[model samples]
Target: MRVIKLTIYEIIFIIVCITINLFKNGMGLERLLLPLIIIILFGNLFCKSNLEIKKNREFIYAFILVFFLYMSIQGYYDYTNVSKNNYSLFKALLIQLPITMTVFAAYIFGIKIKNFNWRISLTSLLLVLLVWLSIEILPIIRYVRLNSITDLIKLIIINIPIKIYYPSLVEEVIFRGLCFSGLLAIGLSEDKSNIIQAIVFGLIHILNYEQFSINIILLIVPQIYIGYLIGKIYINTKSLTPCIILHALLDSI
Candidate 1:
């Protein structure tokens, strides 16, 4: 019964994703198919999450739930907030208060990055190149277009401090670095975990599109894959440094 429930829940999520995909009518089915591929892979490989995360389950759930609440609220504001007195930025920051609070609380509560500086440096350099090179060479990759790649870079560099910083970094750290990896540590494969994470990432933007825009599949599939890549970096490196740096670099591109 538990397995059936989980499977049914996942099926509904995928159907919604597909509904958004077909309705958008812009991108190819290829993008839509990617997540299905991931789901199958996940069922085969990572369905049984590791028992270890159970040890720290309380901290993980608390941290993730808090981040979820903050992001979910801000995501809504990003869609519905109307500005008159130039207070949107301030209001936006106010919405983001949870991220700062969580990181500090997590620290005080004994969640520390094990190797600190060394981990940060190595991940930073590698992610800078990993994401940078991928975007730079996209023309030859047969997957992403050059302009799209450039737009990604521009978003990271230009958008971060000016329009969206804490949201991207804090959310990605929690979702990709924390939720995604924690899932993988037990039962989810890298690919399975990535798309699931990315779908949530993409959903945060769903309403921002005009009611008719269906290009969401393109957005969602890449996000999930990207989440997976960042998760892989953190898991292998045992730190979030590379994932954060690569994410910043990738989104910037």
Candidate 2:
């Protein structure tokens, strides 16, 4: 039975991330207390577990039931939305729900999906931040100057959660958690698994574009590198926490 542990830096980093987001959303001290308390309690419920439960018939059945329910809901939404010509970014996010549910199912079933370590989380975040600053900051600065502060803040606030939950959480759970791990489980070498998942991750982005073109190729090339970097992080750390947080930050900005 392995215990999930956090270092002081990791704990502080998590609290700071939550606090800044709350403050940005206009949560003052008086109103903040309750939400913060609730968040802490909710987080504890997930993090306090020893993750030692043995697999059994009941767990397997429950996993299948929940996974099917998630897929059904997602399928229904896609069918309804696409038929009405009302497919939105929000609706598109539903595509990720099945993968997200699969990750949750693994957690609930006491499968050791990944390790969460403080050093890995912190290092990953910092490295990604540096890369983002170098490559993405200029474009963001130009955009910021053209928009009102309030509008920019509103945009960030609205998009942060979507970015976090969608491409960040969902993609990592799929490529890194499922694809990478699944390959390793089948006795593939780590290098081979990492490369395969990264390529698949990049190839999947083709669905984002309407049709294949040179432009799509140009866009996907970067995504491949990004996927590779993220996959490498997962291989080294065996954790998705840093990948999700850093990927969300990149998309949000």
Candidate 3:
């Protein structure tokens, strides 16, 4: 299974050549404002869902309302927790809100939501509390190395479930759900579109930094491939269910 997954990952990796355009000014939201807005507008305009977007704005709004409420709670948590305050984990979740809420709203309205075999999304998220606590309480797990006071604190900080989940969902929807599927719907073939979208998703992380090192490329490699796998799982199963689980598991491991 590992080998097969790696071969498919390699094929997609080949379509992508690495070109690190370093940004020395440091990352900021302003950098992507115009382009990101344009993409959001375009996707909202043309996305083909089972719901009549114009007619179902109310449903969409309701979902966004709930989502925003959750986000507000997360933000409050961030304000209270010093480490979270530094990470802007709430703000990171906030950044992806507009699109993620839209996809979910569409799902609520009987869209062309895919039907998969295993049929589970957020199962991994459900396990997060257990996995995270295990990392703390258990001693044998390799990733659970509580070497120092600060390290232990960081482990607690990073392992927060809401910190992990909301952003992942937004990323999957924007990258795999919208960009990949939208491109495929227009003209790009499933594999090509997926691979390209995965590349873009991976690039978002690597390029957001000031300078892209070879190590950065290496770090992004597995993630990009995982993004590709999410794309493939969505396309092949014709559902978003597995993407969520696969992504959560990859991050968990």
Candidate 4:
């Protein structure tokens, strides 16, 4: 029952995402199938959730707090930037608020930092690194050929803020923390929660890249697998710390 509700909610969430994307792209209703891949994955993996959100008031409040905090920061950034060049702060909020709120919701729901197992975490990190690198080997080689070691170092140094927020902290918290944890709390098994949330995580990247092409299509599988890896680490350690490190490193590389 609870699981059924969550599944329905997930489906509705996907629809909302698709609708938002269509509006953003100025596309028609017919192209909705492109994003339905996410729904398909969820439907195939659907299971009844026994966990209840009503019991999770603390999590909800935390999510709200984080969401507003992020929005405020982004609003400030937009205001400062736009003041310099007549930019539209409202437009920035319109574009980013949904995604930002979603990620923060996941962070509040999924992140539990009590148990820390360095051994298990390091092992998970290594495994995720291998998987990420293997899938990205071609790109890695191309990057190496294009940039000297110092250049790579400089790039990492310059993009530290970006790598931490976008790929590492925010992504991991949303996927592994909110999606995975919320599923678990709602009575889904660990494995089912991981796979379903992973698929959604991969699908959310559609918005991140702001393109709905075959490249994004090709990315779902790897992203799903990567999401599973991160969820697994979170499950083992009962913490988001390890997953955040692994996700950040994967994105940075």
lDDT of all predictions: 0.49, 0.55, 0.46, 0.51
lDDT of 2 by residue, 74-125 (tens): 4554455552366677655666655456555656555444432223444445
Give the poorly placed runs of model 2, Cα more than 4 Å off.
1-99, 102-123, 148-154, 212-219
Each candidate's clash count:
12, 0, 0, 5
249, model 2: CA deviation in Å? Answer: 1.8
Instruction: Judging by lDDT, tell me the better candidate of 1 and 4.
Output: 4
Could you tell me the lDDT of residue 34 within candidate 3? 27
Work out the TM-score per prediction.
Answer: 0.54, 0.55, 0.46, 0.51
Worst 10 residues of 2 by lDDT: 46-55
**Rank ordering of all candidates by lDDT, starting from the highest:** 2, 4, 1, 3
* TM-score, model 3 to reference: 0.46
Give me the overall lDDT of model 4. 0.51
Please write out the lDDT profile of model 3 over residues 89-127, one tens digit for every residue.
Answer: 576656545534544554543533342122433432333
Give RMSD (Å) of candidate 2 vs. truth.
13.6
- Please report the candidate that would top lDDT against the real structure: 2
Best by TM-score: 2
